[model samples]
Target chain A: MTGQDFPEPGPFATLSGAEVDLGRLRLRLVAEAERESLLDVVYRTVDAPVGRLLLAATRRGLVRVAYEVEGHDTVLATLAERISPRILKAGGRLDTVAGQLDDYFSRARSGFEVDLDLRLASRFRLTVLEHLREIPYGSTASYAAVAALAGSPRAVRAVGTACATNPLPIVVPCHRVVRSDGGIGRYVGGDDAKRALLRLEGAI
Target chain B: MGREPFEVVVERYGPMVLRVCWAVVGPTLAEDAWSETFLAALRAYPQLAPDSNVEAWLVTIARNKAIDQLRAQSRRPAPTERLPESIRWEEPDAGLDLWDALRRLPRKQRETVAYHYLAGLPYPEVARLLGGNPASARRAGADGIASLRNMLAPSAREKGPR
Candidate 1:
């Protein structure tokens, strides 16, 4: 058919109409998934004292906290691969955790009240993460101290690894894991983010 | 290159997929088909080649899901006609009329038109999704557009300037 045979705006344009914005439809779909509990992973970015933080959660609880330096898109891909691939960028499911985080960042709250979903960690690493949470909001634990607390004293190096790979960093308080020399050590969120978190918590 | 996040895929192709689904299944079941299409696409996303035509990929998935919906609908006992409680067409003025016209087209013509025109796939890609050769697909699309033009002409003349 020639162009003249078709409607002025074309059938596709007419059908699209002015009201059916697909971006809004997609957002509604994500909201519907969140309401239906079909969203395997829901994430949103939060601007914290330490720069943009990528917060992701499952129905289980808060699962990951990532730094901007970690590459938000790359981190999301990793989550999609490791978890089920059903991931969406919807923040409705993260309201509770985001609120807690906002409070923590502003120093209105000293600790997080949100549930932690540590399914991304396992075995000794899981043990290390569990210990990392107990490091307290304003205290510091040496890697050796964390290793001992996780019940593997000689696994200080493993403790460092666990700290580096901690899925929920700020919420789980991996920044509280310091070097034995009383120095702030390397962090998954980079040293700057770790320092910012430390400074925010008055641990510096 | 590694696969981009599935969220990117959804955002990029969601409207095209929704439009194709609406054309194939009508508004009542289009939402379900769209959801299933994206969910299935998400499941299979990592396996998708990085350089694949993502639009075409989504349209193919949407077509399959819409067909499945049609099959399920056909299997169900027909209910008496009643006003739907919720109609999702944002533009009530003309979208429903277009949908009615679309639903009346021959299945092949309808699928071809939706895939080629709405989803923006070339005839070759549309043929790959709908089967048969590109020439037949092109012919079907032309026939579909002609049919729509005829169907809408009287309304256009009656409505005049709007």
Candidate 2:
């Protein structure tokens, strides 16, 4: 229940800075940041079951996605401070979505049929997510395709940025987006995880 | 009659206990099991038979806890995506390339290897911990070892006499 229960990024004493005393200051700052991050992870996992939790902040908004986790307190607190206090657990509303996810993992479900709260984003990102949603199950589109679908064919980089900043992956089907050169582009959650998602989707 | 000093237990065999837990259940649940295992061990220590191996006794307790956890997770059937990062420990470094190949193993075999090889328990001891007969534990350990060797030999040979 406490943050100490989770492993944080460990501390290390490095030889840095021109003055040896300054190195101590840097080490203190590093330790403090690491402690804060570890606390964040533990707080986030309090109600979450046992899976990936993503905290994303956009220029205009913030989105917290708790994948397979139990507690919603940490994420709620995060969003409340950054965005607004209108945070809801969406557990009951997400029950249906969970069912679809189960099916997807078992390869019995192909598409997601859920109404997401996308008001946390701007018009451009919202439009991009909508188009990304249509990329279909067991198939992938490129950043360029998503940009074209979002009504700006020249905005491939923008699409990539949006995907990188996406709060939800499987639900939004961001794994369905690929590189123009047949590579799985970088995902915020690490490329291996993205590859795993794609392989699970039978897209690669 | 009271709990042993946690720092004492953690200092003495934290890494060993963690290895056993991670071997059986992966790192995700290792921390909880680790804390619980020591707590249970402390409670049971007074009642422990004098001749019994303390490590085996502790490993058995951890095994039961880990298995119970997995079973509980199975009953829930929720989407794993939303799982909190706290419970998700990085995949264990089995210190060998073949560790990844062990991913496809049935739960029991995986636990057997973890108990026998990774945790460094003898076959009979592993059996006692898993609540199986000595023979079964030996077989499980043997089978698991053989499977890993079979899957890993090619890679080992590719490295050529290391």
Candidate 3:
């Protein structure tokens, strides 16, 4: 049966008994939110794509994409304490990147085309992601092709590692980079998730 | 606000964040969003206004975080054009089974439902939260519900929602 309901919100007490379930669900969400803050108390937010991300910048360029929800100072403290002690917030470094991202989810864009501040990633990985960003929408490549493009023709496995470690995926389009012969290939987000993404994009 | 036991906050609001996240970004992204939401809350707990509605405030943060996740995921190359597969949408269920179903919806549609149903926010509020107009919020809500009904309904021979 359809899950549609009458115009008004359903009468929970009058409907099937799911109050306890609903209550439990609410409790869980609150718990998770609390736990998240605790973790950020230590680690500094990085552009490395941790939890949720908010991309922002000064007119100079994209600044940073915060993984944790605390203020910039809280994030900065963690960054200074852990990860790398050296951190700077360059302006406008991520504006184009953020705008492209906003356009993409609005369904106004099919793919990303922008210059990413991949300094967060290593040189080799940055090169690999650079090639990934060029992958046409709805198409895919192989580990070998990526390796070759990154100037490591024989490092297909290394290419796979790069893809696996990519701090940026969709921006780099690693999903579009697949097995040498066929098949979707391994993804950190899981095969079903990878396949689901492909299906959503009509790539599969 | 007095520092309520962290356990009390968790027991009361954990799943709300989870559902809102799952509704907005789907299962794949919800897990991290869920973790991140609490992490943010914990750090901000000391700063929360004493008079603030903790639920709404937390939901707002969670909503913002979820939106950010959706946006970030878009930049990462995925095989699909649709950010979230429609197959992920499902009615909220007991044991939080509804999360998997809600995950099937597109980020926009799923978000409409989450803000409206789970967070209990009005269309206008949902609009503000989503960076859209009230009309858009209404339309997105309607479209999401319609999609959910269709998705949850049985095969052609089965009975439909009354």
Could you give candidate 3's per-residue lDDT for residues A96-148 as a string of tens digits?
A: 56666556545567876654445456778778877887778777788888887
Runs of candidate 2 exceeding 4 Å displacement: A1-50, A53-64, A67-75, A86-90, B1-162
Best-matching candidate per lDDT: 1
Candidate 3, residue A60: the lDDT equals 29
Per-residue lDDT tens digits for candidate 2, residues B63-162, read 8888886777678864332211222223322222333445556767878777766555776666766778877876776677666566556566467443
| Per-residue lDDT of candidate 1, residues B1-162 (tens digit) | 556667877777776677778888877777778878886776677678878888888888899999999999899985443322223445564666777678779999999888877777778788888789989988998899888787767776477442
Q: Estimate each model's TM-score.
A: 0.76, 0.38, 0.39
Considering chain A alone, what is the TM-score of candidate 3?
0.54
lDDT of 1 at A13: 63
True contacts kept of 2: 0.00
Query: Candidate 3 chain A: worst 10 consecutive residues by lDDT?
Result: A11-20
* TM-score of candidate 1 relative to the true fold: 0.76
Candidate 1 Cα lDDT to native: 0.80
Candidate 3 residues lying further than 4 Å off, grouped into runs, are A1-204, B1-3, B75-106, B156-162
Total backbone clashes of candidate 1, pairs 3 or more residues apart or in separate chains: 0
CAPRI tier of model 3: incorrect
Could you give the fnat of all candidates in order? 0.28, 0.00, 0.07
Q: State how far residue A40 of model 3 sits from its true place (Å).
A: 13
For A2-45, candidate 1 gives per-residue lDDT tens digits of 44223233665666553445555567678666666668888999
Please identify model 1 stretches exceeding 4 Å from their true place: A1-11, A15-20, A27-37, A152-154, B1-4, B25-33, B39-57, B64-104, B128-131, B147-162
